[model samples]
Target: MAIFAKRALLSTGWANNLRVEIEGGRIAALHAETSAQTDDVSVDTLLPALANLHSHAFQRAMAGMTEYRMAGRDSFWTWRDLMYRFTTHLTPDQIQKIASLVYMEMQEAGYASVGEFHYLHHQPDGSPYDRLAELSDRIMAAAVETRIGLTHLPVLYSYAGVGKKPLETGQARFGNDVDRFCMLVDQAKDALGNLPEDCRVGIAPHSLRATCSGDLARVLATHGEGPVHIHIAEQPKEVSEVMAGLGARPVEWLLDNVHVDANWCLIHATHMTEDETQAMAASGAVAGLCPVTEANLGDGPFNGPTFLNAGGSFGVGSDSNVLISLTEELRTLEYSQRLRDLARNVMVVGEGSVGQTLYCGAAKGGAQALGRDAGVIAKGKLADLIAIDCQNPALCALTSEQLFDGLVFSAKDEVVTDVWSAGRHQVRGGRHVARDQIVSNYQRTMADLLAKL
Candidate 1:
């Protein structure tokens, strides 16, 4: 058994200096206002670690490379072209290296878990590897090496666009029929079964544009029992196309079609109407909001106050991995709300502090979206926690609300001094323990990929 003492911050509220005991990768007991004994381990401020509800780990390498001006207006579709070209040259080994680096950065940035929207399945030439799930195996390996809790979402990409169009060359690696996708998911489940129980498998139907209604239904029917994630209404163009092609807006059409619920995460519902937002909130689905990426991609601002008032749930993600910081993501989210409503602290719940409100809401939404019993420091919950450096100037005079505000608004990834996932210390002193080797491997892989590109 291991014991840790700190000012424990539960999702619902905060406690004074406390002692938490862990055994068999779960919290055994928690004692409030407990004095440390000679045998007890001591920590600083401890809070439940955040979960990145959406990510494409391989996209970490493509950060900042796609910001140049293209011929046209350079929308999300244009950015997709760059992403496709970049993804074409990656081998499983390269993917593992990059993913390890990304996951390490996430751990250091105070995210204990990641919901990886992994879709790269086949070789660049569109042929199956000797092991169909080789890429997923590499992702799982990376997560194990980095020690970040993983929700590996194997994405099903059957068609290129609406109406069952054939996948373009760039999308070949991500394409699989429903049956083949299910097979790959099973393979992934088997592979992940060898890892710690904190690692899980989920299904992602890439988007409304990528899969037809029948294909979506079949994939859901085959492997919809676990968490389900999908990109929806990220851009105005997408909303227009989805409406023009399907006779309904993306969110409206999805609500009419799928059984979206708490187990589902609707990524980037950025262009939802007020009615669509309200309906989404009532549907009990978590919105996988990536404010940094949305701003980077010019996807426009989400209706934060409207959605929040309508009882919408949301969790932040480092979607493109251009920037990976729990603090930055949360900050950008609140800042977006500020910019939208021209008001301060627009997301705060009743008499609740802004930082506490954001943290608690994201924790609950992220856990619900990932289908995990996490995001809370309570009995029977997974032991995923992050410790802030009390010595940091931003944390000076840290009350509960101030501590959260400092962590969310002022602190960067470097201030995350320690992190624990499943009662294991994966990060200490603001660094993943294996950062050197992981970063070295990533550098080599990135060098080779860049040389080829």
Candidate 2:
């Protein structure tokens, strides 16, 4: 496959008139200052596809169902209660349908890969599936159907709260003792063997509140080197709970106890103090920020400036799947910072455009978190690429320098015209190749699931 772009965002920076050659799903060569070959497919603007560093694929079906005031005061906990009610009846086939739609949307939204933080493990009756990897296999099948890169993190959710609290009724489907969880991990890895070559399996100790320190250490010690992810400090209540239970903040506990490094992705480190933020940046771990979802859940502002000043790497996720727009995620990140700091371009690093900085940060950190060789337009990297619609009136005047800013801030739907994930043209003309079938399956699944609920 040979692709020529009038202008493209390269790892080195923006370049003009470049061609990318893909061989064996990797970029074999990049020719700059070049004209399109007769055999090349030409486009206007191109970007490296970003990894969606956190996701709950099944949650996509419940996007707008929980918008009402469930109680006097709504919080993440309350929202989670509703989520539990919804997932209580999900069958493996329903999960597969929902996941297919979600991954397809991710590719169309410019996310090449997903770090699926999966925890839905058992039957609604709390019985283990005949195949322990039943749900995990479904997620991998969705990735195969959608042609999206997958790094499945089978989550170990042992407790309902901090300090080894017993699993609540609503969480029965998620429970796994350490031994069973390890077996689940191994089974999930075996399941991936039948999927795409780029698919991977990892371990996620659900959160500090769910996994004890001993089990956390055990999983880290036994699980071979792969990406490790965990929910952390996403709300003030979570921070308060961690402080009371562990005598330290969640990030603080991880820093003090675990050997934090590039392989770890701390999802939603939203309530960090300056010191914790600085330490996290220095630890080389990626902070997985789901800006749109955080805002939707009313999670407080993260200290983005402090973290960035300390040279933190962060990636974006569609967390709740309430909204799935890569541009909106980047826009929400910058807009949230501006709202917090009461200043414009608060997320801009040095002289780079805020959009460019956000995209690059997410790209690099997401690939690191997913343990995939992507997130850059370079030789030998996966051909996970997106082409922008330069003919969009909003982007008509954008120079190669302003292209990212224009797209991130202004252009809306249909702005991205094409996408290739691992050299597969999964999206073209702003729609997934399997969009109709995926949506139809999802609609039927939702009808059945909701009717039961």
Candidate 3:
């Protein structure tokens, strides 16, 4: 058991100099400012850690690798081909090393948990390993080593596209039929058993382009109780293909086909109409926004104000992981909104600070999307928290709301001084405790991968 007093900020509001008690990796009690502290108590300003609602951990290795334009047009489709080629060379051990570094970076950036949208399964030859969940086990092991709360989402990739076309050679490793996918999910559950109790297993259908309607239905039927995430309408071409092939837009078809609710997350719904945006908002599903990746891929801006007004929810992700920072993601999100609408504070509601509004909304929506009890500093919740350096030049002279504004708008990841996940200290003084070794290993792995490439 341990107790710490701080200016605690809850998602609902704030309390000054509060005492938080922890036991067995969960919050036991929270006391307001007047509470007395014992001699052994420690105090700091505590804020609930952010959840990275979507990530492809392995993609961290491919950062900046595809920047140069090819002879043909460079777009998300072209970039994906490069990604597919890159995935072929990675062994499970290499994946573990890369994911450890990725998770470490996430922890340092004020994210205590990550929802890994894992789709890499099978060997490079498209054959199952002796242990079907070898790749997933590697991810779980990395999560344990990094102490980041993980929601491992095993993806089901049945077909090449909506019409159940055969997978291209590059996609073979991620391909799995319905029965095999169900078994893989079971295997993934067993693989995650070695991880902390807070680690969870969820389901992901890779995208509208990767799974047929029948297969998608089957996978969802098999894992209906767990969180369901899918890539949807990320590009104009994808929207056109879905419309031509399925007679409906991606989100429209999804809402018409699936029983989407709070349990569902539609990643990269970047190219939606106003009606589609409003309908998605009314469906109680989360928009898994990845602003940096969207910008990187030249995907268009999301209709933020309209969606929010329609009662939509959104959570950010470090997709592609060219850069990883919660503040950067939020900043890019707001900046994108400003660029599109030509207005500032475009996402804030009545009587709310822009930064506070963004933070609270992302936190709550991310928690809901990942099916985790996080994003708030409350009793009975997992003790995943971050402490920013209030004394930093960007944060100095800022009140609670202003602090958030400055942190989001002015500061970067360097301001995140301390971090804890599931009541375990993983980062202190703005660095991961195992930063040196993790970085060294990651460097070695990247060198080897590059040598082979």
What is the per-residue lDDT of model 3 for residues 1-453, given as tens digits with 9 covering 90 to 100? 454545778645788777777877788888776664564245456788888999999999998889998897899889989999999999898999999999999999999889999999989989998988889889998998898999999998877777888899999899888898888889989877688888889999998888888888878777858688999999999899899899999999999988999899999898888999999999999999999989999998888888999999999999889999899999999999999988888987656788977877888888888887877889999888888877788887898768788988999889888887878788988899989989999999998999999
Candidate 2 residues 1-453, lDDT tens each? 899999888878778899999998899999999999898989888889899999999998889888988549888889998899888989999999999999999998888899999999999878899998899989999998998989999999998888899998899899999999999999988888787788789889999999999999898999878899999999888889999999999999999999999899999999988899999999999999999999999997778889998999999999889999999999999999889888998886676788788878889999999998998999999888988888899899877778778888997747888898888888888899999999999889988987898
Best by TM-score: 2
Clashing pairs in 3: none
Ranking by lDDT: 2, 3, 1
Per-model TM-score on C-alpha atoms:
0.97, 0.98, 0.97
| Clash pairs detected, candidate 2 | none
Query: Lowest summed lDDT over 10 consecutive residues: which window, candidate 3?
Result: 35-44
Q: What local lDDT score does residue 417 receive in model 2, on the 0 to 100 scale?
A: 88
Determine the backbone clash count of candidate 2. Answer: 0
- Model 1 poorest ten-residue lDDT run: 3-12
Predictions in order: lDDT = 0.86, 0.90, 0.87
Residue-pair clashes per prediction, in order, are 0, 0, 0
Candidate 1 on 1-453: residue-level lDDT in tens? 545556777644678878877876778788887688777657778888888999999999998899889776888888998899888899899999999999999999888889999999999999999998999999999988988889999998988777788999999899898888989999999997767887889999999999889888888887747799999999888888888889999999999988888889999999988999999999999999998999899888888877888888899899999998888889899998888878888886556678877887888788778877888888778888888777778787677657777777877777788888777789987888999999999899889998999
Better of 1 and 2 by TM-score: 2
lDDT of 1 at 301: 82
